[model samples]
Target: MDAGILFWKAFCENGESELIDLTTIEASMTDSVVATLPVINPSTYTKTISSPVVVIKSEYRRYHHALKASNEAMPINLLYGWGLIGYWGGVMFLGTLWKVGQWFYYLRFNKSKAKDIEKPNQSSQGELALPKSLAMLRHWILLYIVIPATIGTYHQRLFWWSNIPNRLDSLIVFGFWALSIILGFAGYDTFSGNPTVTSLPEQNWEMLSDRTAILSYACLCWLWMFSGRNNIFLWATGFSFQSFNIFHRHIARICTIYAIVHSIGYTVEWIVYYPKYFKSLKENWFIFGIVATIALSIMLGFSSVFLRQRSYEVFLVIHIVLALVVIVALFIHTSYFGTQYNGYLWPTVAIWCFDRFLRLVRLVYCNFSVFSGKAKTTNASVMYSSASDVIRIDLQPTASSLKGRPGQFYYLYQPYTLRGWENHPFTLGAFTNGFEDSSPNTPEIVKKKVTTTTTAQLSDSSDDAVKLKSYRSSSLSNTLTFWIRPYDGWTKRLRNECIKGGGVCYPKILIEGPYGHTQMLHTYDSITMIMGGTGIACAVPYVQDFLGKSKIAISYTSKIKLVWTVRQPEFVEEVCANDLSAAICDQRIEFEFYCSKKNVPTNISTSVHSSDEVTKQIIIQSGRAPVASLIAESGTEAKLSNSRAAVLVCGPAAMADEARAAVHQALKNGCRTLDYFEEAYGW
Candidate 1:
């Protein structure tokens, strides 16, 4: 026998079976195939062809297969059957119940609240619950409209039929999905396979089938999208039960379904069409790619909600690595020597990859563009905050590679440091041109500084590039500067050690990621951003952009209010004198500084005062802002009753909770709408 047959023979037998060992035949088979096989004794007749090559059917094996098929078929049928019936039924029943509940609550619970509503100064601070009619209507619209609309839109664009000429395929796919829902709702047999039901017109059956498949895929995305959104909302509302299910358990369930169906369905279909190719799955790169992706997807799909929740950091690293693996497999599977899929999904992936590459290129230029500019060598003095809480530090950037967004940060490094690329994130606090008219005493200080310094020495390449300029103009500067507040980490430890010895800590830094920012800025007519402590950094860049574009609104309520509670009034004075709030001088900007320590001196020289714009309207404590005050200033009884405006909040979770309650109360009184935005660093 050949080695292939022998190997198969070994795989077929087991310890329970009375069969001869296949290893005995390996020596015989290694050199040549057997012309005749060995015969078994009469007592060993059952073991004669015990190997898998023996095609004789077994009642035990048949029973096992039948049981498996029965098990598999039962759950699949039940899953589909229950999904169709339960989903639509639940939607209708819940919607009706919500409406009834709303009306009942409004009459029973809200009547007394209505009495309080007539008194604008009532002291009730709790956020009123959503009323019957509006809440019910919102549920209805969310379920029947937004949920289906986004899914349908995705279906139309992402289906295979979407690729056929004139979009015939996409139309058919969308039509099938619509028909499935309509028929299911009408109590028709949704699984019917009749040509009139399951199949489209003969004129375009192929395109129609492709369309139907595409629509099916969209239903999957819709399910996942809703799950993600639900997770976010539940998390926001402080409902731990719902948030846990939606974010962790429900996400895993949906991801598993998507992965299994995506793998098995296509794999089986391909196998049926080309049995030879399927048999060569291990040998074919295309098939291998699919297998690899499916395996990784399964692992990640489960690990995400389960293992990820336990150790988020570990899960994050593993997930990132697995994602890269899966993406690579997907790329190979799709390319397969170059073939395009008929959908937006693949094209979208390709586009996303291209965009990421472009972003990296832009980031590199942002860091090093000055180096390739007209000047080959430039000497610059940069001032930054050190650990001593003093503003001091000088830099000669032979090249200015540091350019970044206001709210964003960067890592820093110098050629003479331990490494040229070791850097850390520091907020770019201020930017200014190099001083032109240096005092006569400055060069003497510089010469002394260079002569006796072990750390002041620089590479020959960097030394030749350090030239001085005569004038200091903020507009003509090429150097990028940052203000850093060190914490208990590598950067902080190094800075502290260096400053303790009265030496400079100059090291190269590697910068990465400037991905997120405030989006949909133009969506509303008015905007307000509230920051706490270092959260101010997130608002600086956005505020600069808003002011620079002259988009500042005139309404007192439409303006951006900078409410920062610091320890000393001098901090507030420094901000005003530094021209931080210069653009908003006559532009209806309000600044409120709440001094936490009463003994701190109030050294502010500007005309701005705590009582000038917001005295009773604001409160500052050591922690978050007073949410009740924000609601009182921004909330409206009539708008709350009608649902008109939106309220967006971004800060700590606790702060967000207070803000949400206040806004919700205003909604119940009459705010037309309520919307909140929160930023998370990473998970």
Candidate 2:
């Protein structure tokens, strides 16, 4: 009989009661058919199967190879998932460790120095040698590696590739790109003979598509993780929101790249392999995938640094809307995979929701209070100074726990305006006790008399000065102030409102945060500040903090120097008359004002000499401030005193860069005890 009949006869005898290993039976039949055939007895099953068995064997082997290939790919997909988690977790771990180290150093060394008298030998001690050495190393890394462009200066100094920012950032992004490419093509065990339109094998296209799709989902989690204002990483690491924002933008680009690759791979596969390519595109999963890719592309295109710098509000709205669209579309696209890939998608939604929830909690806690069945709200008084061309806002929040500190900032919202939801971040310039408002019409003679009497009393007796300080310290009302330089958009409108109300206005303001980490400048022996224009806002609070600490006799900062450069002499005079009045005459502090404009008023020139001995220490000049020389002089002073120093710069881009370069050069020239801090909003 034929081999087909023989196999049928064997199947009837087996009666489906015994399930045979067709794969193993088929393999053995290729070598020796009679020995491997399933039979109750050898005498009853004498017929041999031939070509028919070979045909059936080839069919089973095909599917067996496919299943084997799928099993091999599963672990790689899972590895990509865990790799993302590990990278992010490592960053958080490092941040937490750094924070703990900072706290330990403060408690162990600086705290005791603040409370006790320093021994003469303490100044020459090498106790802080390790930390200073580490600081120098970190500066070297930043100057040579992190801050430079990848290939050339054009990208770093020009607006064309501002998105990447620097070499280190680009390298990090390139690492992810390399990872996706490597994993997409490696470890494939099976391939079909058919070739794709791109000339890649059909199985190669399938694996590449699947891998990129899964990797993109993994990256989505971190993209959302870094976008939050209240990211825990900020608190643990002391990194500014701007640093995380750079990470967010880069991760978004990597994610979009993955998505584009995934989309294109499948598109080519369908066009070449499937006859009904357009029909497949009509499917829900395919359409959602396309939607997600397009949304991501649009988000990346519109989120360029150039465009964001030009119109932030418009960019923000587009970013938010497209973000939602991408998330929803991704959810629908991956829904067909059931719960298999939901692990990556759900965490993304949870992270975004958690961030928004924290923001809501902060808003409620900072703005509203309930006492005896009534709610109280925070109000602000805004005044515009035409001389300085800046807005001064004073806010007193009812929330007792909301205390302002150095380096902290808040988002101010004008609830009564058309765009009430709009808000802007400003540094907390100063905070003081709330006092009863005095009449604006108080006579100049009365003011001069009171001021003269107070000055004489302060000058004549230490006891009287102490009593005045005590009286001021005892009144503890939380009044927070912010100085905003008026520009286009919200700030200009705010200026108009102040102008309309005769240079001052009281608007219902909502405070959203006290964000940012504070630097422990008090731990340093000396401090140098390089400020430009309205960057004085960054300097005033720290000066006041050092003075307050000195009053309590618990500060290590023995010397403070401020170098301010402004366009107008009037602004300098205004700041001196208001913000710098208290600290201006302090013996340990020095002030150097450089006005870029040439025409200095005679009255202003004479005002610096009005106090004679008290104001004689302040130097006023016309020209650009010598940023490098100032930094070098401060370093030299610190070196001579054998004390650690901090150099802080907050100013326009060029001024800040000049200061940074100066500090870096100082470090290279053996200024080991110097630490650098920069305060500027990257956005």
Candidate 3:
């Protein structure tokens, strides 16, 4: 007797029973059957004894064939049921466990410094009341357990909430929620509801389960691109964690859940339709491979964040490895080798790959260009310090001819004289066509010397006339004229170097960047730039550029006003002595210097908070005519209506914010055109 006959015999005896008899059905149906035989069928078979006898139409061989068909089909339904419920429960359980572990670790290890967490601008003295041990425990448990659970619920609710937004955002939210609800319900139903894909005894639900799992997984991938839709949920549930970091963890959780669905769904589907294939994961390498890939990727992404923050090198390697595994698994999971599969997901994935490739190419070009241009250049310049510790650095183009716009800054690296690796960004103070070299090296001299010299060309082609040396001259000269302030770190070192050797030799300067050109000067007809301390360098460049082109109109009357508030009087003296002298000669320019320490010049208005006289004097003083009235005058509105006026602001962020508001107010009063641009140094 065979397994099919025995199973039928036992199943017949146990009608409407929870436990079906396999041995009796197998023995009664099959004769010397190779598949799921009667030999061991009844060892696991049980009966409810609801019916004593049941008639079988197919006798002997045909009945045996039917029993074999049933056994082969059983595996699919069984596996499908187990996979879905098991994996989902496993992830939720593991997440709960991890939280418990974290709480313990934190409380036991870090108790004292729980209150000493660093925050910007706050005094460090305030101590936390919670002991170090308890704080650590609380922090860890809150992060691991409270965070994920909250985020999951929030994610679901936000999906529903997104439907209330503007059409596009709302559509995205609606579509995502609709798909998620469908998949979740369908997935749960696959295990619990009628688990049969087809009525045929040989056909199983494995193919159906696989299709469902793949669709759900694809949906998860799509959600990655929708940031705004997810933000609501992320904020609500993800409050404990930073927003930017939620996606990876979220995806891992979802993937773990669905992977279980796929595993159990297929397993149960297989068991019901094809019982021989039950617990035959090793035989089905394709299914097992995807499961393995998912498990590994989840572990890698999780470990890299929490356990391996200090092991950056290891984490990076692991991350790359996990990405590769994910790609491979995605490929195999979707492949159709005579299976129920589709290829729509690949093209979307390819786009992401191509985008990353292009970004890499751009980064490489930027890095290579910088690396190739890394050559040391030397120059000598006199540094004259004012009473305010502001240094006036004068240099010829031969030394450093890197010209930049006013307000634009360059990272200066001085290698030979001081520490060059620590680069500092400073705005360009002045511009010159070609500086008068103390030791002249003219273009004619350079041309004559080039015949005997051999150097690489800056341009790649041989026909290109731009040699590396000439390119250096232009690029370097255009990059050099920066005005720096002495601060901590490299600034102090540079000042010390300058003081020690009137000017040091073989100074290797590497200009890193040409950042901060927020002001669009071409857009405005009249622009008033306000500066404090060394910020004057930022305001002066565009003023000089526009004025140099003789774009000034007498009948039109364009006023280029500068209000420079310096702590010391020498700053005004130096500017009057050098850079501003030529510009001041022009009637279109108005410069006001507010010297805070001493009494302001009589020519300028003075409002003093003093004990003596309550008289406010508006001075029109003359040592160097301080244009105090011109500074305070209503030229801004008059000029804006007559022409276009833009307030191009560059200073501290706080100052920029205040100045920006003032500019807006001025525009509101009557300024025809007004634009405010802020350049952030730090944040």
lDDT of 3 by residue, 1-683 (tens): 34544574555653544445555754554433443333322223375445323323333444454454445443543444344334433433544565555455345323322332232212111321245586456445433322222222222122432211222223323443454445444432121212122343223245445544654455333333221222223222211112223433444445555566666666665676555454555544556455555655466355543334344435545655665565566556555343333343464365456545644443233223333366333343535252345544443332233444545554455555534334455666665544421111212111111121322221112121122112224322322344566665665666676567543323434544344432435334455666666777776666556555433221121557666665544455444433444454455666565644444332333222112222222122333212223322343654334444545545543454455445444444544334444443321
lDDT of residue 310 for candidate 3: 43
The positional error of residue 630 in candidate 2, measured at the CA in angstroms, is 1.3
Question: Which lDDT tens digits does candidate 1 get at residues 441-500?
Answer: 111011111122322212221221122111222343444344333444444555565556
Score residue 281 of candidate 1 by CA lDDT: 69
lDDT of 1 at 624: 37
Best by TM-score: 2
Predictions ranked by TM-score, top down? 2, 1, 3
Q: Each model's TM-score?
A: 0.44, 0.81, 0.40
TM-score of 2: 0.81
Clashes of each: 30, 0, 80
The lDDT-based order of candidates, best leading, equals 2, 3, 1
The digit string of per-residue lDDT tens for model 2 on 93-205 reads 86689789888887766545644654411342255445657776776765675544554442313355574345655665566566656665566665652211223476777
Deviation (Å) of 634 in candidate 2: 2.4
Better of 1 and 2 by lDDT: 2
Once superposed on the true structure, which residue ranges of model 3 sit more than 4 Å away at CA? Answer: 1-386, 391-403, 416-420, 435-479, 502-506, 516-523, 551-557, 596-636, 639-642, 681-683
